[model samples]
Target: MPKVVLLFTGKRKSGKDYVVSKLKEMLKPEDCSIIRLSAPLKKQYSIEHNLDYDRLLDSSPYKEAHRLQMIQWGERKRESDPGYFCRLATEEEDKPVWLVSDCRRLSDVEYFKSHCSTGPAHPSCVLVRVSASDEVRRSRGWGWVGGVDDGPSECALDEVSCDYHVINNGIDEQLDMKLKELKNFIEYNNNG
Candidate 1:
């Protein structure tokens, strides 16, 4: 089990990936790992659809074109097994600190809390919500898509309480401070 598991959730273009990347940099590379749940999902989708798995992982038009369908496919898999993707994401993670860069549902949180957050070896799971105004996201190339934006994958955790709330609106100083606080929290928990 990891010493700390940081589960992050946010809307598209809300900088969840960016913030997690920065957080990873703050910690020693060998001690931390960024786990994306979508990677496995996309890989499976790509294989079944005969699409390019690498292209589906990026934030490009190719990914956007298949986003809704991919979400639906993932949802169906989750319906049968809620922890399907969660298990795949963390199966091989051995780092003491796990930064789950994209946690889209309550099931994802439950999976980590139930599986990884238990025992004396690890601290409780931390849920961090990275958020930005729609305007800011739009400026970052996010445009509302009907089924994709309004779907469960995007809205499942909208009202879920989080351990930390990060407002990423292009304010470097503020973001840095929050991230530092988070890094400190992780260190404290790990050492305790």
Candidate 2:
């Protein structure tokens, strides 16, 4: 049982969590474990800052001002010590497919690729990018502060590329279709 890690990022309320939840339902919890890298950091930050964890994590101010640095530091920490994300992935011990949601840095992807590339325990990973308008995201109380400039900046585009791009413009049906297509692709390749 190899793994399928779904890497994604977008403004808060852009359906990253909702979409991942839907995928989990479709795939079943036994077959997959959806994990986020920033989740722990978000918890710690919230505790230190006295902010709601959900709101702080979804806030645009957090993303715009600190996500990059936090992600970079996380990557360095992981490199120096390999068990950071790996431990979380293996904690459940069910060998369920690991859906690594909220994978933001190139180093994060690189770590997974290096560790899960071989053996029966190997992971079949698929990178997915979720996108949506800031207005839509903000209205949902996602805390998008950057306004219209929230789309991936040029640096982001160059830094991270996805195997699949899903524009989450508020159509549940369409999102289902995209996730289905990704599932089909993963199944096809893994079988082959």
Candidate 3:
């Protein structure tokens, strides 16, 4: 079991991936693993739709074209089982530290918190929110999509409390400070 599970949530282009990557760099790579909840969703979506799964995983036009449909499909799956994707993402995980790169809903947070709270090797589950201005996200290729940006997956955690919040608007100093704090928290938990 992991010593810590960082459950991250953010808008589409809010730099969740970037921040997670930075965190990974700050930690020992062999002791940590990055988990994307979207991986299983995209894999299933690809098989069902006969699309290339690899393409769907990339930040490319192919992914953009299918993003809405994929989101809808994932929502349906989540409705039937809130922890389906969460379970899939961590089913084979054995790392000491897990950086869950994308957590979109309150259900996702609950799933991790509940599961990580009980075992003998239970880890400290930390909820982290990453945010960027509309202008910054737009500059990073985030355009407002009706059913996507305005959907529950994007807005569900808007009012949710988080243990840590990262404002990633491309300011180096500010981002570094937030990330350093998060790193220190993780280290403290791991050592405690």
Question: How many residue pairs clash per model?
Answer: 0, 1, 0
lDDT tens readout by residue for model 3, 97-186: 889999999889999888775444534898899999999999998898899999988999988988799999999899999989988877
Q: Under the 3 Å rule for N, CA and C atoms, how many clashes does model 1 have? A: 0
Query: Considering every candidate listed, which one attains the maximal lDDT?
Result: 1
Clashing pairs in 1: none
Model 3 steric clash pairs: none
Cα deviation of 162 in candidate 2 (Å)? 1.1
Model 1 Cα lDDT, one tens digit per residue, 1-192:
888899999999999999999999899888899999999999999999999999999899999999999999999999999999999988899988899999999999999998878654555588999999999999999999999889898999999999899999999999999999999988887777
Residue 48, candidate 2: how far off, in angstroms? Answer: 6.9
lDDT of 2 by residue, 106-146 (tens): 65666666665554443466567778777887677655334
TM-score of predicted structure 2:
0.67
How far does residue 175 in candidate 3 sit from its true spot (Å)? 0.8
Show model 3 residue runs off by greater than 4 Å: 118-123
**Would you list the rank order by TM-score, best first?**
1, 3, 2
Number of the top candidate by TM-score?
Answer: 1
Give TM-scores for every candidate, taking all chains together and pairing residue i with residue i.
0.96, 0.67, 0.95
**All models: lDDT?**
0.93, 0.62, 0.90
Q: By lDDT, is 1 or 2 better?
A: 1
